[model samples]
Target chain A: MKPEAPMTAEQSLALITRMIDQAKGNVTRNAFYFLLWGWIVLIANLGMFVLIKLSYPYPFAIWLITIPAWAYTMYASFKRQKETSALTHLDSISGWLWITFGVCIITLIAFGYRINFQINPVILLFCSIPTFMSGVILRFTPLKFGGVMFWIFAIVSFIVGHEYQFLSGAAAIAFGYLVPGYLLKRKESQ
Target chain B: MFDELDPLLHSQLRLAVMSLLISAEAAEFTFLKEKTNATAGNLSVQLDKLQEAGYITVEKSFKGKKPLTTCRITTKGIQAFEKYVNTLKQYINK
Candidate 1:
């Protein structure tokens, strides 16, 4: 057996600092999830925009793509959980925020038609909550700004006519998801 | 007067491990090894010591065909770590 050496207080403190930094670095490796959802929501919004522009008989039907998107998200989350042996507190909080956001969205969609309100605006409003909270949790300024941008777009969507709401929704996703998602990926790579 | 540090967390490797675990919900054995730059044998010994002291919990399960070991800090461990840090602070201030 190797002899154990006692560590000085300074050395112990340094070791603790280094280990904490390492744990924080590990949290960024999961930035890919932001990219995944960003692309999905972006595509869905653009698709809906095109359908509405073409005067498709069932323009609203395009939103159904989100169903498959949700399914794929569930599958990906489970797969990720299986591959990793540990989760950070940050990871757990971020996951719950998104999950709660998902539940709110599904509830909104299910009951939206009866509320006499435009769904996209409400969705955009709801989107800001989790986006901002995630940004705060991750301590990433870009995400926080992205969340604020979504709120601005949400108000715009509410003021504009229903036909133009899709465009606003698309813009919200662009700023809130795509931009920050790419930034996060770049930060992780560097 | 210098407060006594908890012996279980006084060593370099164990303290480093506790520091990593303090912020995380849990961590894998591989992660600990990678962060600590310790050999598997050495890390296993240190982790066993921590587990025996009730500072951490080790769970063994199979991930597909390979065996997996994950470690999580216990509530007792958190309190001990906090006390250790506070004691260290006192020493530094003195």
Candidate 2:
């Protein structure tokens, strides 16, 4: 809103909030995706772990949850596309990097049966790229740490048994995604 | 000691423009105009004032033969803005 009089402190703060929301520099929305996938990965990891322990017939069925999650992610992305028009160069880079990650991860999974479904370590290895790049892009240390966590756990997954890989995945998502996601969200909100 | 709010940024239009640029790597002239609901002539003048103050840099270029003007906030502008906000906060608290 245009003000006829000089801006008050309240007006100034409100204008800052409004403009920041409209700006391409508002990468705070990235926190949403991080938290989303973090929770999903956590659940999927633990679910697979528990299913295997209980001797369930289809431990891999736990991954089916990603189908709904993927649908929701696409819907949210499209909605955001409609709400925002301005995109900074860095934002496009972050976006394209993640898209590339999505493609690579899917290809790995599709061909995973060939390797007897031992794709967890490789998937975690793939995780390092986007996570590290996003951290570098945002200049946030926590996210960079998150990326390194994935690298550590990917190696850890190789040394451990199949069921325990799920545990490491959960740990990785917790420290990696959920922690930085919450921190990033809090920083932006403040 | 109380500090005076920067007069250049105390105005609504200029402050609004600065607010937008402060959060953006860069923004288009049309984006500022549309967001502020200011007319082209008025927005142009406000942008010029900001540029003169060294609070912002405006790059005029072309996109497929159409003139494009983009604005970005400078380091000095960021310092001025932070000071302005801190002063405004003290006044508000008082």
Candidate 3:
């Protein structure tokens, strides 16, 4: 009998199909993990900002805490990308870091311009528009949801102004990032 | 019942490589190798197979003087994956 030709294209294609399903599963799980970590960082960063502003001798120095937080986040993200070969994992972390960094800078400016500035968190609403669009582009639900939360909270925060900004931030962290992230992780485990 | 499963995806390593590429927007050769736990020579061979089959598209470039190979799933690959899952469902359900 003739030696069997290398596996047929149809066969290979079939195998690749199954593989994609597995990959999709992995991608979703990784997305969740990134969101969780993102929520953690957001909560910690905002909490620190509030505490320093209220009680610390030098509140401005407190924002420096982000440097270490960023370093840790990047390190953890890099390791996960290496271990899983799941590009979505790294992408989610990188995307969120960019979002958070933007938020921090804007907040700093708001604080600096306190007397002259209207202290409008309303500006933050504009920020989430592009981010939400990006989530649709990436086709990841968690990031997409996070983006929407940003938009929704932006409106609420702006309506309430600085009075309820911290509470808004907390709610955003919970619904936008934390819950979604944990659910993704739980689904993957199943 | 088992006949419904796609024969191509039956290989262990090829399946792993495709799985890695599927999750990534793009993946480098080294990334695929580490994730699949395959040797460079072996991984390259399997990648060539996927490329030849048109299920994946590979791009070669130099990253800071180092050779880099990146892979992404083609549209054809995506369709094939969906069909394969349906086939798998038939087998499992049976």
1 against 3, candidate with superior lDDT: 1
* Weakest 10 consecutive residues of candidate 2 chain B by summed lDDT: B19-28
CA lDDT, candidate 2, residue A21: 65
lDDT tens digits by residue: candidate 2, A49-130 = 9999999999999999898888898898878754443556567688889889999998998999999999999999899889
Report the CAPRI category for model 2: acceptable
Q: lDDT (CA) for every model shown?
A: 0.84, 0.85, 0.62
**Chain B TM-score, all predictions listed:** 0.97, 0.96, 0.90
Give the alpha carbon lDDT tens digit for every residue of B7-63 in model 3. Answer: 554466766676667667787787677656678887878778878888899999876
Task: Indicate which candidate wins on TM-score.
Answer: 1
Q: What is the lDDT of residue A186 in candidate 2?
A: 91
DockQ numbers for every candidate?
A: 0.60, 0.30, 0.19
Per-residue error for A157 in candidate 1, Å, reads 1.1
State the interface C-alpha RMSD of candidate 2.
Answer: 2.6
DockQ leader: 1
lDDT tens per residue, model 2, B1-94: 7788889898888888888887666778888888788888888888898899999999998765778888988999999888998998998888
Candidate 2 clashing pairs, residues 3+ apart or interchain? none
Best by lDDT: 2
